[model samples]
Target: MGMNEHDQTKYIFAQSIKDLMAKQPLDKITVTDIVKHSGMTRQTFYRYFQDKYDLVNWYFEKLADKSFRQIGNSSTLKEGLVKKFTFLLNDQIFFMQAFQSKDYNNVENYDYQCILEFYKQIIHNKIGDIPEDIMFLLKMYCHGSITMTVEWAIRGMKESPEMIADLLIDALPPKLEDLLSDLR
Candidate 1:
């Protein structure tokens, strides 16, 4: 299928941001820089984005959506979660850098929400019943894990993804442990 105008513009904007991020800090990037790099006008950029933060949020959201889709197809929760984490960490390195620089506060929230949504789907599908308390715990777990993962990457991914995955799996609640093991 052909790309729509909006889709094309968004694609350019995301790429422009990625390019700019590679060269400098996110705080130094401006809409004009994006427009200039993207070869689009300021009007075109504003038509699709409110500001740089909006674009940053959108970029992470799109990555989250892709990560969720990958998780959905995996046969095991551990594998799915590991795959999603690896994908998010590797694909959005600039966001990780920003987090390390303390220039952005939304990456953790964005990742946590995406992970929780993915977990909710997995629980709903496999167990078909979710307690509110468990859901709340899952959200807490996601936030903590995402925060640690970002810190880990910022610290140079000191441990391999597999080691990190094992740590995360061990950290899960007992009920989830039973469910994931059964799935395996």
Candidate 2:
């Protein structure tokens, strides 16, 4: 709450976008609408972001930073995923609106890549001996997991975050969770 003017403006802009997203799609929300909701001038919005897409990317990057710390510090990967998904569900309206857009293909999506990198770090830490081949395998699994997550998110996330996390954990190769849990 001790935010300076710059920080407060950014927060206002982000919250404005999130609020607008709950009512309409991203494509329909314009710079004007954002400025209006944020109670800022056009120049102010441009000062902080290139466009709504840039704001969206910044939002995802912020989530990724928080999620990475949670995952890295977690005792188990499943615990980490549950924490991450719980974070997402807190802003489910904005996430659903973002997903409903035709903009984010799995490959081009910020959230997807962020999840992939998060899992890669998890896999890297779980293994004692690292091999180049194994790293690729881990990346492959991360990619697949992120892709599936995107699908689940786009479906309105009908399942609870814990349920989704447990389902994802269950899908991992047999003994992988045991191996990771052992490392912890």
Q: Top lDDT: which candidate number?
A: 1
Estimate, for each residue in 91-153, the C-alpha lDDT of model 1 and write its tens digit. Answer: 655765555544444565666676677677667777688888777787777888887877876
Off by over 4 Å in 2: 104-108, 125-132, 174-184
RMSD of 2: 3.0
Candidate 1 local lDDT, residue 77 = 65
Q: Give one digit per residue, the lDDT tens place, for model 2 in 37-91.
A: 8899999889989888888777766776667456767777777888878877777
**Residue 75: error of model 1 in Å?**
0.6
TM-score of 1: 0.82
Query: lDDT (0-100) at residue 45 of candidate 2?
Result: 89
Q: Against the hidden reference, what TM-scores do the models get?
A: 0.82, 0.81
For model 1, what is the error of residue 71's alpha carbon versus the real structure, in angstroms, after optimal superposition? Answer: 0.6
Please report, in order, the local distance difference test score of every candidate based on alpha carbons. Answer: 0.74, 0.73
Give lDDT: candidate 2, residue 126. 65
